[model samples]
Target: MEVPSSEELLQFLSSCLSQIKWRLKSNSKRRLEIDVLALCTGMRPVVMIDYGGKMPELQNRLLSLLELIREGLPVFKDLKVMVIEDMIYLINVRSLPKFVSSSLDSEPELFFIDLEQDPPKMVTQSKESNLGMQLRSIQKLFSSTFPLDDSNTDTTTVLDEANSSQTSLCIDLSCCLQDTKVTIPTLNGWLLDYPVVYLFGTDHIEEAIYNLSTKSLRLFKVLVCRNGTTEKDSHLEELTSAI
Candidate 1:
């Protein structure tokens, strides 16, 4: 079976997130020895692609994977999302009890996917979906990281713990600052600069503002605009705060 390239994974994530919050970047620091990392709106995210746990007999490799995820706990700001691909089929065929035992955390965004499909999307239905949903308990984590956006004026919804001493790294609004016309040299530079993102826009770019202001499930942290969108088109007062 073929695997989706890193580029493909980025695009897939962009579609899921709406391409606003993250941009693909290389693992120069090799944080967690990850093959791919992306800059997210309020946090940095790491994606482990095309990885299936080692054979049950190879306990060492499996243990290593667990340690890597555990060590990265603080680095991810408690928001680690793992999107599995064809590996689900492998698990279904032979129950890997240990790997399942390891990922049973309250936090971390867990997704089940079938790469063989034309578009390579998340698995929403069937037997595997139920198991995946049980393991992905993302709410337990986000309940602590993000706060309820009761008002439209709230732009940065980072929780207090994120700013506390426990979490050394905190995402800020500095990334959106621009007076200079910065030139990104290459694709690598683009990824490094933009990183991986999830965008939800109203008109593909500004469209997200309307959705974000009204709805609570914001997929993006930083809002992207091409022609300088303003509150004229959007009804919410907080629409201006997204960028």
Candidate 2:
């Protein structure tokens, strides 16, 4: 994928900020938009935004902004927003390129935008400062969540590990906001594309199966069969063999 030049990215972000300012009625919401632009363009992997105890309001505002970005910007489609305590975290997985390319001991410079000034201003925080500590913490969290087994591996290998049959995957929906309702057509579509065997559970079995099957389909054509019931292991073995 081609990365955008700094100037091009800034111009696009400026336009987005202007539109957000014009559309959002609340000052706080507009400020959130500015913060988001700062972090995203700054290429910070994970940074926390203080919601000031107004999580519900900020979450709705953030979701609206994310939807807008998702529809208009293909580059940020993989961006994930997570709420933890009073802080809202914006994780740009694309930022990993800069980290992966740099020396292991090198500290990353942090960027922030000051919109109070004319034309907006980009501020760079040195790696020697306190922000560096926070940056380290952010990197630690990111690395823990998505561990890289080999530093020499390409970015695609780092992010896309679903192709490995031995990889045990855990689909955590709590970290994200997703529509749980599954239609018959959607299920049929999934069934047509891949070999999926449903594993019914005590609760939300369809949603569970949908999440697993859909994510699996994105990586490669592989059989996704989960067992939540008391079915015998022999039965599952036979089913896979038959397929």
Best by TM-score: 2
Q: Flag regions of model 2 displaced more than 4 Å.
A: 1-30, 51-53, 96-141, 147-243
- Candidate 1 C-alpha lDDT tens digits along 123-142: 43233432233223322232
Error of 1 at 77 (Å): 17
Candidate 2 on 1-243: residue-level lDDT in tens? 676553455456456646665344455443444444545564345445454236667665555556666666666565666543344556565564345334134444334322223333445434333333433343343344444453544323322442343212111212211222222222222212223322222234445445544442233322323234245532221111111
What is residue 180's positional error in candidate 2, in angstroms? 33
For candidate 2, give the lDDT of residue 83. 48
Cα RMSD to the true fold for all candidates:
21.8, 25.1
- Candidate 2, residue 152: the lDDT equals 41
lDDT, residue 195, candidate 2: 31
Q: Number of backbone collisions per candidate, in order?
A: 21, 0
